[model samples]
Target: FPSAEHGLSADTEEQLRMRGCELIQAAGILLRLPQVAMATGQILFQRFYYCKSFVRHCAEMVAMACVHLASKIEEEPRRVRDVLNVFYHLKHSKGKRTQVPMPLDASYISAKAQVIKTERRVLKELGFCVHVKHPHKIIVMYLQVLECEKNTKLVQTAWNYMNDSLRTDVFLRFSAETVACACIYLSARTLQIPLPDQPPWFLLFGASEEDLREICGRILRLYSLPNVSLPSMLKEVDQCHLALDARIAKAKLAGGGLLAVGTPTLDVPSSFSPASKAGETGAHHSPIGNTLCNKNSVHVSFQKKVWKKHCSLLCFIWTPFWVSALRLTSLSVFRRSRSVSSPLRSVSPTHRQKISRRDREREKERERRRERERERGRGRRDEYSRRR
Candidate 1:
């Protein structure tokens, strides 16, 4: 799709993708699909949208299609009707009608059709590459290899992190093994579980420290908690204001004692008031006569001069062309008016008579030429008869 057709900025598109991920998780729960199936469906949804725009496609329909396709790909086939029924049930439960029975109504039929149509589109967008190797299984396997399988807390937390990671584009950006290692490492750190740091555990999974750090940072930012110390934050804000004032003062000094035009002047005490000094300075530097209020008057005057010069130049270049065009148009209009008023006004009576006489003479000359040609042909035929 063209960039304009996406109908979303970068930030908005990311937010939409995050919302889609949440819906995918919710739909998976509603349908009671396994964890792997849910993860697969989320991956498929993200991949499809990487090449498609959310504005042109309905998110709910695409999410439903992803779940449906995931069921089949994961070898746990669920009918389209069942999936759509679950969606409709969840949708109505939040509204006034909580006990609406699923029927073969128009809405239900239309939803089913949409799901099927979006399912094919999703598959085509993915290039039929529906098989996604998730980091969940890899995390479990690695936990076992590290002999940390018995730590249920660590394993469970890492598993949750892996699920959360699907909401991001990390799946498309990084390899499964790298993501798996990062999640496991983060889980261990969160739980304060010790690991052998001599060789760094991530190296075993072929993940660089920088990649792991980037992944962990993204996960942290996703789950960022509110600051608990509000007083410290306020103090930092005050310090920032003071520093900004200092920098502004320094800039004024560096620029030959000329303050920024819009800056508010500082008040002075009566004993050491420099009002006269300020007035003198203003008289010397102000753009208008002895007034500081018209600081922008200089710019306005310069702009007026530039505009006048530009207009003059344009008139110089285009005046003759416009005048000639207007003259030609007026002449054509006058001719048209004369013709409309009286066609004979276009030519004098004498000129008309001369034109008619020339035409008659030309016609007679043409007739004489044709007669001579016919007589010559007859003479040729007579000579041929005599020879025979």
Candidate 2:
């Protein structure tokens, strides 16, 4: 079948192509391509399956293009020419080439143009399934809960660990929800903590319990594997990427929905505030029994007259009449006290002028002393120079 090519099986070449597509999709993430590109690739793989056509090109290039289109749609669009030229160089370079024959003629501009056309086809094939649910978001939520008593660095280490779990075929077998739950489960165990309850966010994907457990086990194995560094695991992922990407892309594009046909839409959590706690009434609690009390009734009503009449004398003293008068009187008293208490203000103008004149004379005397000192220094320097 390696030589045979172009057909279906229990494990078909087409299935392999789809697998290649998923790896490519994952690599696109490392390549810093937009998420839409993965979506685009997914759509393209399904379309390619329906057509059963095999072009003698780098599967990575096509997957990249699919991703590029998705990026464009998602507004994370790469420069079409850049995508083309980079892949073109990669295709022509034998050491880096993904397949037997590479398509160097697939220049950046040409690829861009091709993607533009492919985008429409992809959109049609996917039935315009534009929104994507990423595990990265779920990973963030899991980290927030897991790190409740820890710093961000601990959570970050766990998140970094979980990213490797994503590269495996587990995502294909499980929904993003289940995969996210597994990541959380593994992250908690890695930190040597009790596995946190799957946050409400995981329920958004509606994964079955059995599937989620399987996903969790695979993630745990990833944690236990010796000498399997994240970078190396990622590189291996890169090697088999095109096939993985193809599988994922095929599934996505074949979609009635991402997981199942007409799956109920999951409500996205608005934000993680104290107010977002389960069944809590907003940020502040209502005053005691106020929820049941009548607004217009005397007992619960917040009336000004009730406070004015019954409140402490301190409250009456704080009334506007007393407050304003007291303020004005305080200002008058402050002015009068200032006038009386200030010796400088009470002093006659003539006497004050005399003090100022004496201060000026003293300042002049100091300046004269400084000038005399400078002259003496100069004279001493001149005497020393003559002696030398």
Candidate 3:
């Protein structure tokens, strides 16, 4: 195990952190809960790298696994089945037996599995560096540096703003010290958080003045804009977020509401139903509560038959509910949801009786309205004839 004395050089550490952060941010944004899961994955990543030496390929797998692992650690965990499922789905494979692309074939899975199996080896090599210093803690320290009195409304707003910045790449590239300074700087200037003297090293982080200006500018843009829909330029970033959520939700449903990532099934309660999001009402769910798919894989079987509607090009389309929710909470759902609608047989006993009843009531209401309109039209016509 490497000690603090034997740790990697600061430059090397920055590169590793940057790499790890990229994977985590990408996965989290794709999965939804970008800030929360990214923070969780970052802690795991720093600890993992702090111990064992870096092997280029193994490091990538460990980073992916760290994110896969951290998602479960946070309340929003993705299923292993979903992870493997997407790996297959992207290739248009029907099952796990299908061959993957040349480079990321079974060999890749084997390599990743090896890393996962011996993750404890890497952990042991790191001298058990589980505890991590987070940006939230640093924000508290900087608040004291600025002699901010308490977690008042102003203090809370600044803290929340700093948390938002962490979602972007800037926090990963810059040190906590530099980030703390910039955050305080930006917060004081934009949010009007009072600061007497600017910290000296605010201008001396590894990032160039141009980069820092851009980072701060994005943060400022976020603050100034009145929560408007982002323009088309940000679609890829938005799509990544949606894809991640669909991957997780599909896995959970397949796994019966628990996602197993190299471990036993952990219970994740069902929140949003895919059917409801697809505008399918009165469809019976699987016998299991939110357990819609295979626990080990993404193959799902529902209780009732569902008509298959394939919009291949629109497979990644987000439901309006998903769009609105993600707009508010920033959760993404990339897959087109599956919903079952009532059968078309108007009088078939096999069809839902309630549905037929509702349709009849609607038809009667429409007929009444049509009759009233015809009466009004006749009266107008008669008045015109009399005037003539």
Candidate 4:
């Protein structure tokens, strides 16, 4: 998975994947979505994690979004509200078997928005190729070809195995046809029903014995493992994420020279990396959360290419329309936001001089008025002395 490529451990990533798949399966049952939808949802969850990291996304939220997207892809759509309600109870039922569902409040609204946004992210990552070819029907077809369709026990066993295998990464690694053949092989072995060893039946179906054994081994491992608790898995993922964030924050602090080389100041952007700005050296980079493809690529501030790319993006971000609409009233505020860089310069020099002159005149008038008041006080004091 892409997460493993980053920093997530193998065991943690595997658990999170399995837990997400289990959540999808359970939510599908509660929402009355088809098995194909559940399987598709699980596959999508795997594919997404392959692109994103576990530290970057909440596994539970992504799982819910995958199920939501999968339902729509399968044309068995469930509304966001229904999906939310089902998951709310499913998550809340940790202590109580009959946990009450959460009401449609601000929290639900926020969660609803997250699910929608996450769905977009999933679709974006998958490039809209949401088509999932399930091996459930393939297993049936291959069994029929083998004339074992009459054996309900064998058929059901293989079918269950196919579903269980979805919780693993076998779908992403192996083809649907191979998975189907492998399921048949395992089912026959479990029932002690001998198939043709002369030619090794799976080979006829394009699945080698090595592939079948690998898939079967993965499926069997799932049985040996304990059931993953969704809430606990989420907690573990959150902890890992928090640790990662802290590490990244530390790296950023270390790299940016904040409190490392000097005290932090307002001109952090310009002075953040003085060495790079002076063309002395490349800016230090944090290795914690860099780009997925390239981790060691620190932003070279002295490089014109990097600055130009960022400037281009900023140019699109803050057009005149946005800058005019912003509540940047003070000159200091304008100076602070690069979006409205040097608004002070926009005023003509003559206009600035006129404003400075007007301020000087106001100060002189105040001084003259104060002198007159002092004179009147002296006159009163002199008259009192004369009377005395």
Candidate 5:
């Protein structure tokens, strides 16, 4: 979805999405998350990229953020520390070098902060509509409808197709039901099983043959594509960013570094909401994305406190947005270094209730009962002393 203004070709954006979705799936497994949560995270990741480009952001960070956000949205909450730990382990487990993982030090704290910030960014871009409609369950339901539910192989194949489709824009372009139908259609054909074609089984599910074909094509196309490596992908995106930066510098030199002044800056305040419109786009339009930044400058949080001049988005006016977003107050973050903490979230804190007058009087009566008991013991001790 990278427009011509984004300067990256559609293929590059697609690769970023594919790799990000793969990361979400892998992270979900390491975090022991359910398939639905993983799918939801993948959908959120894609929805984000539909508005943001790879050039302006880090794919790995966004992938982790989506997983973190989705887990909570799905009611299976994992703490920021646990999410970061799992992601860190997975990241290091891939290499031959035995790198001792960074302890829960300043570096980890920075990464944790980055995860929270990135998660907020994703939510903001999406207008906080993180609900994901997955087709995996629908595949089983449809299989049962066609009396093929008992066919384990076919069912598994369709389910796999649905999962794979998460790496593509088919979910964004079509309904979950349509994608489910396409998955079943592809699976039936692959397994050499005949479905009811007289009325076309998909028709019963409200999907046209054309919709099935389009979706199936996307599913099949995913397998044909080569796997994307995270490191290589990062390098590629970095190269694009470098090229973008160079172009911006050249333009600034040509325009005496004043071309970006009148490009219409966005007032992305801390209270920025969907109603706070940016540019000419609608209220629900992606705020810090296509309209805000034209690739002049990006302010991203990097681990080890390494900041990259990752943007040359002249029209974006991203500094103020980053400032407001970063100035957010988090009590948990403040207390992070002051105390030991668990990685996974426990029960939410309960509020202190006001005590009733009766309950308070009962509490006072119990105290008086203890006072009488002490007085009796003192009296007995005094008598014993007299006898001695």
Candidate 6:
């Protein structure tokens, strides 16, 4: 009966993902699997949660299965039992002192069963698309292509960035090429390595500067470096979600005419008017009586004045951006529809007439210019013939 509302909070979910990434790395190290396997497993674990909630599934079991599945997919298979044993050792040895030791009774069977079950679930959630494209190969290819492979420090830093990026959701959101470009960009910036400016590097991968900038921002935000606080960012994200929910609720209420006649009585302050007190004290107090009272009238007028002033200020602040956004969106939609449909159907008759008139005038002007040029060329030919 667990719902999303009762599930993990934003901060907790991020922490759990970080833990899962750590486990994937540890398991990879313990099994002697290549870094690619670890990266693939981390991506699988992250992608699985997009389809299934973390509240319903255990993170540890899923992480182990991901690593196990990744090894098989990478053609470096590890036994399910061996993977579980590695997890068991990691938990018991590194777990906090206050943490209760995992029960030995039926633990092996349960752990192994959970790993297999979760592995199947992960595969199903991923739609059997086990092939994860990691940025490591792309990083190497980019370094070689850019002729920067000789800079061991830069290459190693970029490799570390790619590894760190897997801990975040960038792998799920962006392409391997983009992530590779972003990592390399960040690494170069960190090392003060000057890259070519005329034709930026990201363009080679068909990625724009903005795309690389966004990916790098996400990666930097994930690292929560000295200037960036993860908790504060999470708080801001939660606030934005809450604001969006509030806007939706307000729109629903407005559309339903539930708040059309009057403002909420509960929201009006009782101290502002005696009528509000009458409504509270007298059982037979009429709803209209509150609005009829002179004191109440004055209070309502003042509230309305203040509300209008605030609305005007807000409109002044946001009008330009809102107008521009709407204009751009409408223009794009109109262009798309015009391309798909007949020109006659897309534009009104009046506008079409205006456009046709402009086109005709342009055509006439072009014809006149072409005639003038031809006449001048003939006169020049005649003069040259005379001179000859």
Best by lDDT: 4
TM-score of each: 0.55, 0.40, 0.34, 0.66, 0.65, 0.55
What lDDT would each prediction earn against the true structure?
0.77, 0.55, 0.55, 0.83, 0.78, 0.78
Task: Give the range where candidate 6 is weakest over 10 consecutive residues by summed lDDT.
Answer: 257-266
Task: Point out the higher-scoring one by lDDT: 3 or 4.
Answer: 4
Give the lDDT of residue 159 in candidate 3: 71
Q: For candidate 4, lDDT tens digit of each residue in 1-388?
A: 5565445678778888888898899999999998989999999999998889887888888998999999988999999999898888787876786777688789989999999999999999999988888988899899888899999999999999999999899999999999999999999999998888887777788889899999999999887777666567667767776776676567566555443213353334544575455343332354332352143343453466878989999899878767775745565565555333555653556656777999999999999999999999999999999999
Better of 3 and 4 by TM-score: 4
List the candidate 4 regions with Cα displacement exceeding 4 Å: 256-388
lDDT of 3 by residue, 1-388 (tens): 2211233344433444554555566656656655666676766765665555442224455666766766765667676545444333433443566655445677767755764665555456555544434567766766775567474765676676666564344554566665555666666676565555344434443434455566677566544533322122134324434554565677677866443222345664466667565334422444443443244234433322232444432444756666777676642222111113323444345355767788999999999999999999999999999999
Candidates sorted on TM-score, descending: 4, 5, 6, 1, 2, 3
Question: Which consecutive 10 residues in model 1 have the weakest lDDT in total?
Answer: 225-234
Top candidate when judged by TM-score against the true structure: 4
The segments of candidate 3 whose C-alpha lies over 4 angstroms from its true place after superposition are 1-13, 84-105, 108-112, 126-129, 137-182, 189-193, 196-388
Candidate 1 lDDT score relative to the true structure: 0.77
Model 6 over residues 228-276: C-alpha lDDT tens digits? 3334534544654555457557845555433322323234432467745
At residue 116, what lDDT does model 2 achieve? 66
lDDT of 1 by residue, 96-185 (tens): 764776889898878898899999999887788887887787998999989999999999999888889888878988999999999998
Candidate 4 local distance difference test against the native: 0.83
How many angstroms is residue 139 displaced in model 2 relative to the true structure, after the best TM-score fit? 2.5
Candidate 2: RMSD to truth? 21.7
| Candidate no. 5 TM-score | 0.65
Q: lDDT tens string, model 5, 1-388?
A: 5533546666667777887888889989988899899999999988888888788878888988999888998889989888887778778888557866659789988888898899999999999887777777788888887889998999888888888988998999999899999988898899899988787888888899998899888778777777767788778778878877786666565654232322432334455565454443542456556544544334333422342233445325787777666666455664453343543322223211223555788999999999999999999999999999
Clashes of each: 0, 22, 13, 0, 9, 0
Q: Which 10-residue span in candidate 2 carries the lowest summed lDDT? A: 1-10
Q: Positional deviation of 272 in candidate 6, in angstroms?
A: 50
